[model samples]
Target: MPHSQDTTPIVLTIAGSDSGGGAGIQADIKAISATGSYACSVITAITSQNTHGVSAIHPVPLEHIESQLDAVFSDLNIVAVKIGMLADADIIQLVARKLRQYTPKFLVIDPVMVATSGDLLLQQSAISTLKQELIPMADLLTPNLPEGAALVGKPVPQSEEEMGALIADLRALGAHSVLLKGGHLEQDANSNDLLIQPHSSELLRAKRHPTVNTHGTGCTLSSAIASYLAQGNRLHKAVYLGKQYISQAIAHADELSVGGGHGPVHHFFNGHVNVR
Candidate 1:
C-alpha cells in the first residue's frame, strides 16, 4: 500500500459535533477547507443542536477521544490545531495532556462557554482547569465577550480601553496571544476584534452585517485563524485574514436557509471549496 503525497497543510480540530452542521467540527472543516487547508477532526462531544438551541449533549468517552488523537497524530503531520467545546474538566485535562504529547506548530484555543441561544456548553468547574492547563499551552486564545468575562472573573469589556485591559488580564493567565472577539458587544455598524500579543495590540475591524445566521461565528473564526496559521501566515496576519473571511461569511449568511433560528455563516462564500 502506498500513501498519496498530499502536500497540502493539514489542520486538526479537536471539537464537538454539531448535528445541525452549523458549528463545532462541521464548521471547522468547512472553514479550514475554505482557507485552502486539509482539515482533520477529533470529536469530543455530540450535541443535539440547531440554529435555535441545544437540547442535549453527549460527551465522548476519554478512551475514544484519546484514540482519535493518536490516530490523527500517528498518520498525519498536523500544522495547526483548533480546539473547541470540551464539555468537562476530564475532557479538558485529557486534551491538555494530548497537546503536550503531540505539540502542533500552531494551537488556537476557542474558549467556548455558551451557545448563541444562551445554552451553557462548558461545565462551570471545567473553567478552572481550562485556564490552568489548556490556556498555557495555546499559541492563541480566542474568547468572545461572555467567555472572556468568565475566564477573567469579571464582566465583558464595555469599551475599546476596557477591551485592552481585558486582553492584558487574559495574557496574564498564560496564552501567548489573546483575541477578544467583539461580536457579543452592543450592535454596531463595525465589528472590532482586539488581538493582543506580547509587545503590542491590534484591532482588526470588519463591517458588521445585520443577520441572524450567526450560529457558528466563533467556531468559524478560530478555525480560519488556525487554517491561515497552517498556511504560514503570521499571527496578526492570520487573525486579520480570518476576520475578513468571517465578515464575508456573515455578510452573505442569508444565502442559505438552513434553519429558522441563527443560521450558520457561508463558509464557502467564494463558491468554491479549496480542499484538494
Candidate 2:
C-alpha cells in the first residue's frame, strides 16, 4: 500500500556543530524536533567544546558548505530556516548568496557571536560582513545582549530602560524583526525580551530561573521560532510561543545534570514524567 504524503513542516538549521550536544546545530535540531518540525542541517563549522568552554573550531570547507546547502535546499521542502554561527566572512557571504538564490518562507538569523563560555564564535572582522550580507535578508533576527551590543557597537543594556533605548538602534540594523534577549541582564528580576518590528514593539517577560544550565538558549529560541513559523503560525505568535517554550525549558533545566559547567535546558521537558 502506498503511504500518504507526509505533511510535517521541515526546518533547516544552518549552524555549527557542538560536540557536547548542548548548543549550535545540535540544540537547533533538538528544539526543532521537539517542537513538532522535521529537522535538517548544514553545518558551517565543528567545535571541540563541552559545557566548560570551546577549545578549538574547525570550519567546514567552502565547497562542502555550498554542497550541503545545495543538497538540502534542492531535495527538502524546507518551510523555514534558522541560521547560527558562521565562522567568518567567507562563510557568511556564501550563506547570504545561497539564501538569496533559494529563499525560504521564513528566515531566522541568530547572530551567534559569543558563546556562553565567553568564547568568540564569530570573528570580529566578519561582523561587518554579517551586517551587510545576512541581516537585511532575515525575517527575524535573534540576538542576546552581548550580540546585540556588538551589532550596534554599543554597551550591553543594563536595565529595561536601557534595553528599550536600544530599540531604535537595533531597528536600524535592517532586519524585518528583532528579538533582543535580556538574559545577560543578571541584575534584573525577570528575563525580558524586546520584540521590535517595523511599526510596533512588544515586551516578552519570563521569570528568571536561577540556574547556569542555559546553554544554547539563543539557538533553541530561534529554532523554535522557525519551527512554529514553518507550522503556519504568524511571526508574532511564533515569537510568543518560542519564548514560552524556552522559558519552560530553562525552568526545568535543573532536572538534568548534563555537565559540570553551564548545562543545557531540557528540550523534551514536556514529553517525560519525573517518576521519582
Candidate 3:
C-alpha cells in the first residue's frame, strides 16, 4: 500500500538477522522505526550471536532471499532501502538483481565486513560482487575503517585527512557519496565521521560520541540515513541527522545495555525522552 497520506516515510532493510538483537536486521529495524519511519525487512541470514561475539552464521538460500525481497517490495511502499550483510556472492548478486528490477529511490549500503571483535563476516568471493553490483547502486555508502580498507585494498587510514582522501577514492570506485566511519580510531576520545559527495573534494565532518557500546553503530547509522532519505531530506542533511541520532544513541547506550561485552546503541533515545 502507498504511504498513508504520503507523510510517513516507509523504509526497508535487507540484511542478516541478529538473534541477540544488537546488530544486523534487528538493529536496522530498531533504528529505522526509532526515527519515525515505517520499517520493513528481508532477512539475508540467521546469525547466532551475543555481546561477546558471533557464534554461528547460517546464510539463507539465494532463492529464499529473493522471495523475501519480493514479498516486501510487492506489498510495501518502500521509499528507501538500507542493505547490510549479504554474506556470500550469490546472495549479493540476488540482491543486486532485485534492486535493478525494483529500483528504489534511495539506496544506502552498509558494507559490513568485520565484527566488533575483529572477526571477518563477509566471504572473499562477495567482495567483487559488492564492488561491482552493490556499491554502484548505492546513493550513499557507509563503511568503517576495516570495511573501507577491504573495499579499496589499502591499509587502515592513519588520519582524518587520509580517511577523507580514501573516502574520495572510494566514491570514485562506485558510490555517489561515501561516509567513511572513523569509529575504529578516534583521536583524543573524539570520533570523526566524514561525508564526501560527488564532484566535491570537501569532506563534511560530523561530531562523534565516545562510547564503547558501538556494536551495531554502522548498521544503525546507515539505516537512520535511509530513513531520513525516505522522509525527503537531502543527501548531506540525511547524513547529518543520522550522525546526531547515532551520537545520542551512543551516549545513552549504558542505560540500554543488553550484552556483557559490546552492546547496542539506544535507538529509541528520543522515544524515552518523550515518555519522560
> By lDDT, who's the top model here?
2
In candidate 2, what residue range of length 10 has the lowest lDDT sum? 1-10
Encode model 2's per-residue lDDT on 1-276: one tens digit a residue: 542234679999999999999999999999998898999999999999999999999999999999999999888888999999999999999999999999898999999999999999999999999999999999999999999999999998888898898899999999999999999999889999999999999999999999999999999999999999999999999999999999999998888888899999989899653513
Writing each residue's lDDT as its tens digit, candidate 1 over 20-135 gives: 99999999999999988999999999999998999999999999999999999999989899999999999999999998999889999999999999999999999999999899
- What C-alpha lDDT do the candidate models reach, one value each? 0.91, 0.94, 0.86
Cα RMSD to the true fold for all candidates: 2.8, 1.9, 2.3
Off by over 4 Å in 3: 1-5, 202-208, 272-276
- Comparing 1 and 2 by TM-score, which wins? 2
Write candidate 3's Cα lDDT for 1-276 as tens digits: 554736769899999898888899999998998887989999998989988899899999888888988998888888999999999999998899999999999999999889886767899988988999889989998999888988999888878767866855687768888888888776735677777788764454555666678889899999999999999999988998998888888988877747789888888887644423
TM-score of each candidate? 0.96, 0.96, 0.94
Off by over 4 Å in 1: 1-6, 273-276
Q: Largest TM-score belongs to which candidate? A: 2
The residue-level lDDT of candidate 1 at 74 comes to 90
User: Residue 111 of model 3: what lDDT?
Assistant: 91
